[model samples]
Target: MSSAMDIPKGRASYKKKDGILTLTDDRTFLIWSPMPANGPPTVSLALDKILNLKQTPDTSPKVILKIIEKPKNPDEQEGQSFMFQFTSPTDARTEANALRDLLSQLLAEIRGGDPNVPKPLGAAGGPSAAGGPPPNAKPPSNRWYDDDSLKADTQLQQSLLDKDLELAKTHAQALALKSDSISDESFNKQFWSSRVGLLRAHAFEQHQKKGSYNVLSTVKPRAENGEFKLSLSPEQIQSILHQHPLVRRIYNENVPKLSEPEFWSRFFLSKLAKQLRGERITDVDNSDPLFDRYLGADNSLGVASKITAAQHVPHIIDLEGNEENQGGFKSGNRKDAEMRPRANIPIIKTLNSLSEKIMADVAPADLEPSGTPESGAKSFDDARVFNQLSLQDLHGEREAGSIRLNVKDQTKFFSNHGDGISGEDAQIYAQQNPEDVLFEVVADLDTFDDDGAGGIDLRKSIGVDDDSESDHYEDATMSGIQKTPHVGSRAARRAAEQQILEGLRKARAEHAGGPTGANAVEASPMGIPPDLTERCYLTQMTTTEFLKQFWSAFLSSSSSGDSSEGGSAAAAAAAAAGELAYHVESLKRCVERIEAIAAEAERDRLRAAEARKKQIQEHYQKTGKKLKWVPPKGGRDSVMALFEHTTAAIEKAVALYRGSRG
Candidate 1:
């Protein structure tokens, strides 16, 4: 009572929101405390400290979500305590540990039939989740484990209950405690078990020591001993029976199932009908009369001494006749027997075996053809008759269709891994997917043009050879200019455009030979320069638009000249017909070079991959990575396309550089 009173007094209220102790009334108190052996009793203070409150409600120990109002009975007001709940995680472990120690001490004092024990925490109130015995402690085998409201074993968890893993653990704990406990009853049981074990062990040892002997209490076997009697004691009989091959085998065959008494009774000492029990002799009992001729005054000694007298007989035969042939054994009485000749006839013996004899006399004639073509056989004794086949094709099947095979030998296929892929691709194909490979080749063209009007194919783009003959174009106009920093420097490009306008005017006024011979220089009449060619660089008009315009203009002109010439001699017609002549060769070369670059990139990729593989191999060799799987025998494509993004960048750069030239 002194220890219990040491606790502080308070209302022991908790926050309705998070169970935080607000110390609203400070009526906290302990109901019990622990007194240790030889040490001062521990004092418990139920202080409303709220020492380890969580910043958030989630961190607090879960209890009931209190939604009800305060009780109307003022004196009986008591909140459902959270003694059932785990303390906040932020709580000091030392404090929680101390509580457990106090509870255990209280339990120990109240247990073991102690009459002065206080009521358990659950018995006083309804029940404390932490303070009461575990709900699973006294469950029935079936229904107790099948409750739905409880979280123990719903349908989801029924498998665990069925396995009885928890029950097994309980049984294991009990077994451990039982093993630790010592008692006289346990000792007696152990003693009896040990005694029985020793008896069986000694019995086996004696059997082994005597080489072989019957331990089962069976009977002695009756046996023949000529005409007289002969028998041994049970031990001697057992020794003999143990040594007998067949008898020992029977005993070994049945000993594991047989009881000691029944084994010997049925096997060793069985009695035969119409026979004296355990007797070994069939001779008459009247030995005295049988040996009377040799018996002396001492009948026993005389009977033994004349053992061979039993062979004597009392009959004889004599033969007599005139002129008898006398044998060496008897001369006084003899008779002559008449002689008769025995006939002998030759036998016609049936043939038992005709091995070489039949073969030498007979040969088989050729039979009807089987319609099946006979092929590949060079001689009659061609021993190679069976067709060769892959085991994969015939593993579960009996025979393949009888088509003649081109190859008659077996072959083996292998990959980086050891699994061979001979006969079929089944095992190999599953390891890789077809989508994981490079398929499309890169496209290449000799030149890039960007103009609305179809432009002439750049001579440099197709690697032009020097051919200075200018007669191909009659009365054609051409313009040339130096662009290396104009000396006058007052917008020289403007002067160039003005020169083009002035040249057109002069040509139209007949200052130059005709408008057909039109030309321009760095000056025009009005001096308005072409701004786009310099301000914005362009290599060519967009090729697709340029082609449409150029083809239409050229066809219109050629049609006015001659109808047949429009289709035959027209420039558009020639250009279209000579597509191969203009760019195909250069495009082919460009493609070859691009392909070479791709191959180089592929090689580099492979080299890097090989280096990575070496690094991984070294790591695995050192650490034995434990999951070093042997890759299956094959894959779809050996290489994968890695669109490096650099080619796109290069193409963009080329386009940029080309756009700079007017």
Candidate 2:
């Protein structure tokens, strides 16, 4: 495998000789095409599954795949990736390379399966691969439909086992964390302003180290009905604002401005954060030394990091968080006896050196507990490799080009973990910047005239059902992206240019029409690199595109933050985004409640209309009964109720929103 492609163009192009689609990363995907009537993807075949997996073991390699059976049959399949963090750019590259190597090896193992023979495991009670029933199994359904919510939810939910629910819950927790940094924080104005320089530096490190850490938190409003408390301090406010995707976009806008070290390094303790949280940028094998340094495992796409904290740090977090034995990683914070631990030294040094002057600062009192108990690194630690799963696995939205994940519940995980930024701002930031992102791939290729004019069905060795109306049995597979010509042909080149210009024009027109999200695509002088420009995106481009865009914005944010990583810049705002999200979610609930009432009103209106029509018809049907004018009734109260319900909810939510704005 060359540069192992994590997400290849979710499309396939085949060469006649091989009859297989060869990707740049050497991942040759074989479509069983005309998916056998019984093989619908996503199944495990263990000894116990013999009775369940009716398809006799095939000679072809068992492609260990996870097929997301979407609500629609046309949705494509998606894969998962694990991620890890690094302190430096080099480490990021190294981590990515390591994952690449693992993936290659894993794929190779998958391809080693026997192709012609079918192994028969003993048990027998499943459907056959050829659309027949096993010993005594029920027939497969040929149609899908939805008549009612309860009926639909019940049947569909049956397909999801307890195991699936467990997986879903795990993902939900990650989403919660991705939204908010932490819940509670007095993160007042004085401290927030004072930390700006330091915070900017941290932002740089955060992006450079971890492209994007899907974090979440939940914040309870001080008031029962409002979205936010009226008394949130400026620090808290700033924190929430920073997390806004729009605000973050602004913060990182025109990142070329931060290529200078002097401007970013203005803070006295800027380098301190760099040292404590990372390794030197140099010594990385494949990535730029400076930018590649301080990588947080999953973000680095094979960049090497000179740091080896993982080699020395020893921890023992159990499958479930417990104190029995620490998990298995060693380095840095878990110091291999080389670095000093500040446990006994006290944090006064850090507190005093917070600002530019390093003047006197009050030390936190040890008398009464601040009740802000801090957990050691070992508390939430997991295997670094296990952490390599893509941000979706860590957060949600299991594909590229998907809508950025929203921060619905913020107070689940990131609450008062680091610098305190207000909860309200955290909620706001999350709403503005969505984690569910989108993207479109373009492949660099050449086009040529079809050698033969009559090539309607130049079919492959792959199965093609002649009886079926659809040429491709599966509508949702990675077969949708059509091939395009390369740069050589004049006509092809002209067409590509025209398309590009058209897209730009449309984008500009849209921008003029309305406000786009802060991170919305923009025109830039330094366009995508011409050498590695994409020809077109994969069929499953949405989710992949989202990942790419989010990462780009994230990287830009990192580049824009100042050298000091301890301040209020992005950190505070990120916190605030979390808080604001809570407000939005609450507002959404209010909307839902109003919508429910409106629905009831609509039903009642229909019922009343039916009754009135029946009475009118009855009067006409009678011998002497006659009706002249029929008065409109009940509509006033029902409509009024709907309005009142909606307005009241909006009012509460808007007030909460305004509170966060201040």
Candidate 3:
């Protein structure tokens, strides 16, 4: 419960008529009130219009807004002050002084005067507009904080200011990069290598740890032995089967006959039955029966001897019941078997007979001690034979389990304290009540790949073929599809088609200027001879046009057969035409091979694409959902057109050669 005096300063409640009181950076401060069937009524005073200021502390915490000058608005009055209440109690004098100082600065800037100069007092002789105390002012006797408290407060405020400034600088640098005000190289070299990037990286790491969409990389889930596994109770499993999508998929696909409990029981412990029924040995060894027996006996002895002397001691004697010899009498439904020793007289006689037979088989000289230590020499106590751990002694054997005693403390001080439930008894209790046991989950610190350590590729752990879909899901979820402006729409399709056609037109024009046939022997634009070029050029002209040009040159040379040089001219024309024909044939064959290879590659690409689509379809069918996908139909068509254009040009050139020879 807070009293009126405990109310925070600068808090105020507005009435229904008071729509809002807003202070904006647009060079104005105003209090608004609601108006029916009209815009809100505003009571605003421009910052420049404020001239004089006054403070009235008699009003307690509430304050009045007083001004000497009004704005050039017709509705406002000059030298009038309006009463405005804050939502909470506030210092009337302090608020008045702050407003006075602000108005003084604003007015000074507007009037082109020094803002720090004190303004003259009003007719009522109130405080000057500078909001400073008069000369030779006295400090108040009662202050909110003492000198020491104020100094500490100032130091904390300074620290906060420094931290805020540092943060502002970092944010400014980040913003500069975002707005492209700074070059990426410069930002990376400076700010990115600083604390900001490190902080962001750490935050991202923590987010990944807390199960982000990077689950594929981070989770590494394996039902058998993966880094991650879901430990669920029967009820949790049932809930998952009913609610979780993946679990439901598994359930619906298999175990149609089994109930929920039975299904999950088999799911969690499916290998148990198989383990109990051991794998059969395909090759039976009938030869060397003694060797086989020796092997089996050795295996059993090795397994049975695993229990340490301390562990074996618990089984030899009832450590739990040995507390005050509780085992000497009968417990539960059992009678005292030790009390009826006379009943085992036949067993005793059999044991005696066996002992006498063993003694008769031994040589007395061989059984004698071979060597003995000197009388004064100390002999070591072998822990294996001398160990006798009582229930209390067993309790604190494990590391960090014991209450270590100080060796320096010779004096003893004790109340009633007993080692409650010794380690042996606790072990018995744990075995009986296994459900209460808990195992701590500890992370393996060794980061090197286990497979790599054994000279195997660690990537084999992640089956690419098997885990591709899971990886795809993770990638899709993390970097999901974003709708772009130039995708899937009819306008976008038309734009894409136009772009492809324009590119093809440019390529056709470029090929037109390139050397072909006889011109191919000439040097290329890069000063490399066409003979050294990797590929030959096919003619760009149509078949009919090329034939007309070839024949005209041939006929002109034949007409000059009468002249002595006419024979040579005819020979040159014939050779040029024949060479062109041969080159055209070679080009046609090359085009055919190229087309075949391209067609094969396209088929392979389509096959792979179809396979991926089929995989997606199967996944959708399993999930019982359909989602929209957009592929670049225009781009694929454009590529096919380019290939067809090349084939058509080659065929035309070959056709031209056939006509010219005729």
Top-lDDT candidate index:
3
In terms of lDDT, the poorest run of 10 residues in model 3 is 297-306
Q: Candidate 2 lDDT, tens digit per residue, 1-662?
A: 53444532111111211111112223322121111212111111111101111111224222122212112223534322211122222333343334334445545443223121243553144555666545323233322221232122332333332335543343233233232443222212211222234334433443353222111122222444643343333333233222222222322342336532221222112332232222232333334233323332222121211111112122331222332235432322464665656442223322222221111111221111111122133322334423533354457544666688689888867765644757887777667634332211111111222336643332321232345554331342346755453333344445789999997865454333223343322321112111111111111122222223233333444455444366667685574455455545544544454455445545655676788778888988985677764533323243333245345645654565556457
Give the Cα-based TM-score of candidate 1 against the true structure: 0.12
Show where candidate 1 strays beyond 4 Å: 1-580, 626-662
**All candidates' TM-scores?**
0.12, 0.15, 0.17
TM-score of 3: 0.17
Distance from true location, Cα of 531 in model 3, Å = 29
Which wins on TM-score, candidate 1 or candidate 3? 3
At residue 129, give the lDDT of candidate 1. Answer: 66
**Superior by lDDT: candidate 1 or candidate 3:** 3
TM-score of 2: 0.15
Model 3: per-residue Cα lDDT over 413-468, one tens digit each: 43223346678986787677434343221222133236645654444423233333
Candidate 2 local Cα displacement, residue 298, angstroms: 89
